[model samples]
Target chain A: MNGDLSALPGIVALTLGVGAVATAAMLAPAVALGFCLARGNFRGKALVQALVAVPMVLPPVAVGFALLILLGRNGPLAFVWSALDIDLVFSWWAAVIAAAVVGFPLLTRACEQAFGEVDVRFEQVARSLGLGPLRSFFAVTLPLARRGVLYGSLLAFTRALGEFGATALVAGIIPGRTETLALGIYSRVQLGDESGALALCAASFAIALIAMLVAEGWLRRSRP
Target chain B: MSQRTSRIRCHIDRPGFSLDVDVGWDERVAVVFGPSGSGKSTLFEIVLGLERCAGAHIRIGGSTFDDEAAGLYLPTECRDLGWVPQSPTLFPHLSVSENLDFGRARAADRDPAARKRAIEVLEIGDLLGRSIDQLSGGEAQRVAIARALASGPSALLLDEPLAALDLPLRARVLPYLMRVRDQLDLPILYITHDPDEAQLIGDIIVVLDAGRIVASGAPRDVLWSRAVLPLSEALGLENVFEGGIRREHGSPTFVSNAGLQLVLPVSLDGDTRVRIGLRAEDVVLAADRPGKISARNVLESRVIACDDRDGDVYVSLDAGEKLVAKVTAAAAAQLALAPGSTVYAIVKAQALRRLG
Candidate 1:
């Protein structure tokens, strides 16, 4: 029973790694989509926004099921995965893909609100100063909107840390492979290891609390 | 036309308002003069290529920025014109020095000499280290202008550069504007609603009213022209005189450069050189000098021209310096006002507003 507790560190590390990798994977796409929603005026924008927000509002298990079918062995993309000789389902990467899908909407929405707060005239002035569109975005718009973007990323990362239903359905409870803190807590309770579940719960709470405190401190220090 | 002349033709149609103007000038400094909502800023935006007008043609300093007929239109960045907007739109995230560097980095060719001159001319060398929010309004405006100049633009587009400042700040910033105009040797398109600023700074003036060109010529003539009298009256056009003050019989008197001595309501102090502004409606025209009148500085003058429009007469007077008087048509008829008619101009001491 004491030896089973040795897997605690591996669970915490895998959880942190999944959250970090998921947040990093979605950062660029989220910023681009957020900027487009904030500034672009075109037809069918509402449809695009609604589609992007589906994973956030839908049931997490349902999203995991959808992803399973899309990347499963018998799925339409099975040949592509087989051609690459990569097993996506029930793997560590499957956990990352699930976490990224759920966190994308949160990060993208935050980015949209952040970019909206920036005045368009600043970009116009930048262009007048001889900066092209991309350069102006980096030099003026992105810097001004960095706070909101960072806060959004923090929200998505924290959300990813606690993701259980999707990760459980897709990655399964394979210790040191795909079992994160959330899945480990659930698996320990099923195994009747009450002390192990409580210990994992405490570790999850500590990491989340520390992450939030550090993010708040960093954000406050950056205020101009 | 000279090789460096600027020409612009724009026609914008909108609901309840339309701006249609076709004007050109050979002078290096052209002032777009008009009241608010008269499309003065719109004209500048068109020149800056911020607003695209179909079939419009713009040529400044022998460069064709936009020509619909030629299928050529340069973007705002490629226009190569320095634009100082109404507000000092300095980047809040950057310090003054960074803002200037941002502009300088994009120049076609790096010219350290021009960048140094812009900083020295605006006297913003001390402000380079400060962030935008730490600076006052006047300091921010100077930094904004310097940032535009640091880009090494081909021409300059200044939209009411002094309008955002208060009277004292305007006075402080005017010299820097003059320095940019005099020292830079660049073609400039300036927008201003103030007649005094127009007269003092512009080599030529374009008067716009209700989105149309009412008159375009020399500043004094364009504002005081017969066609622009009604619009100018709405703008509160004032007759400005530059002179020195002297003590006469325990009261201060203003001796204008053209040699007319007039009593002032305010006491003179510190600097003797002063600029004063009088509204056209403030000057009273009488056939004979009144006796024992409360008004001071009654001077004999001859009418240079008489413009009768919209039930009012705009009488141009040459009383050592140019002055305009506005009176009803009935009053002009009673006084028999006409060109070359000698009249006594009655100016009250309190009517003279001190303008620096």
Candidate 2:
């Protein structure tokens, strides 16, 4: 338990670092996708939307396998990146990218639903009032959809924190580097260090509980 | 060819229908009278630039918003037009004050002074800090109106803004429109199908029917023409007949359209095709024609059709064409007027509307 608990600081950093990256990756695209789905009329939108949701539905390990081939040293991605002299194979940053790929669609889907739920009537009123589309989106649409977007961001963060299979497959479980709480605990369990694994599991439970509480609070606030 | 505010004439072509409307504003409240789906909103949308349709050339205050001949289209945000939709679409996120500011591109001066002036004009100073959800329907509508007027637009287009509200609520907000007319001093294109509203707000009334302009002129003149007379009839206007001028001595009496000659209750001019309306309740039907009756106007006609609506009977009489009259079953039974019965349809002078 002492050794397990000593690893908490590094695990917490890994979780925070990965979560921040995931949120950064998801937020911009989520907003753009939300607006596009809310207002755009185009062919192949359905296909693009299904492709977005696939990462969410696919097993994290399965997504990792696909990414490994695409992003590995001898893979197509690395061949392209070879001229840039950047290594994506076994690094903490690679783990964050892996987490983001798995978590992005959840945030985006929630944002799309939120944006869709806002009545276009408000936008019409703003336009009539001389507020243009850019001003209208910021002044009306964004504020109305805030609660849903906020909750979606929170979910993305929590997902990135709990990510294990994909992160481990893409960015090997290097101690104090790529090892998040989930991956750290898994490594300890494989070594038969039951006490260490138990400590990490308790810490993960506490973080997950806090995340759920925040999400529930936001959900309640979004309603009447 | 002549331009004051510049005559607005545009032809907007959609899939199967086109909105071809021509309006010239000199110094009158022009009413766009039409039913829903008769391209009412589309007309306003083209003006506002929210919709794009070919061959729409719109100019307000000598600024062209759209000119299809020149391949130009201004976006809605830059149209500089005031608009009020049927639904009171107040921004849920903004307070009453912010909503007004969103359209205050007109007063480019001190922002606070502009807002203060808006609050004063709209009389909504107290509602400035209040959120949209807290406002009532009437309050929300007033704010929406206030917000539109704050911009000091070149043109104001109101699309049946009072239609969604109940009768009492509509009555409440009408005075504000009067204030807008007086205070804003902008050319208003008020759209509605309600005749009463048209008569009230319209200086020049344009009647739209089935995607075409059936009639357009001064309010009274349009409503009083033979071409537009049938519309007034359909609106339950009592049929007034020319009852002839002064029975034997000096008095003004008129003949009705159905050739019913009667004495004068009020002063009326020469024998003409004076169309009128009879309220079903106004006409007191009798079994046999009474000669010495106090009522001024009376006509003999046969019943055409009778149907029971609620507790009253809606009886149509074939005078010249179909003249609909309302009567109770008791009145119908007393007269024994069922389809083939010939009876006298008595009308008051006041119920007889003149079509010039």
The parts of candidate 1 lying over 4 Å away from their true place are A2-5, B1-4, B14-17, B108-110, B241-275, B286-300, B329-335, B346-350, B354-356
| Highest-lDDT candidate | 1
Tell me the deviation in Å of residue A61 in model 2: 2.1
True contacts kept of 1: 0.48
Which has the greatest DockQ?
A: 1
Candidate 2 segments exceeding 4 Å error: A1-3, A222-224, B1-28, B109-114, B223-356
Tens-digit per-residue lDDT, B205-280, candidate 2: 8777666777888765565455665575465334333223544556455544444454444544444333233455
* Predicted structure 1: lDDT: 0.87
Clashes of each: 0, 19
Q: Write one digit per residue (lDDT tens) for candidate 1, span A4-121.
A: 6788888888999999999999999999999999999889999999999999999999999988988898899999998999889999999999999999999999999989999887
Please give the fraction of native interface contacts (Cα pairs under 8 Å between A and B) kept by each candidate: 0.48, 0.73
Give a tens-digit lDDT track for model 2, residues A1-224. Answer: 43547778778877888888878887998888977976788998898799989999889998888888888778877767687878886787888889899888988888888888888877876776667798888888888888888888888889888887788898889988898888988988898888888888888889889988988988886642
- Model 2's CAPRI class is acceptable
Instruction: Compare the candidates by TM-score and give the number of the best one.
Output: 1
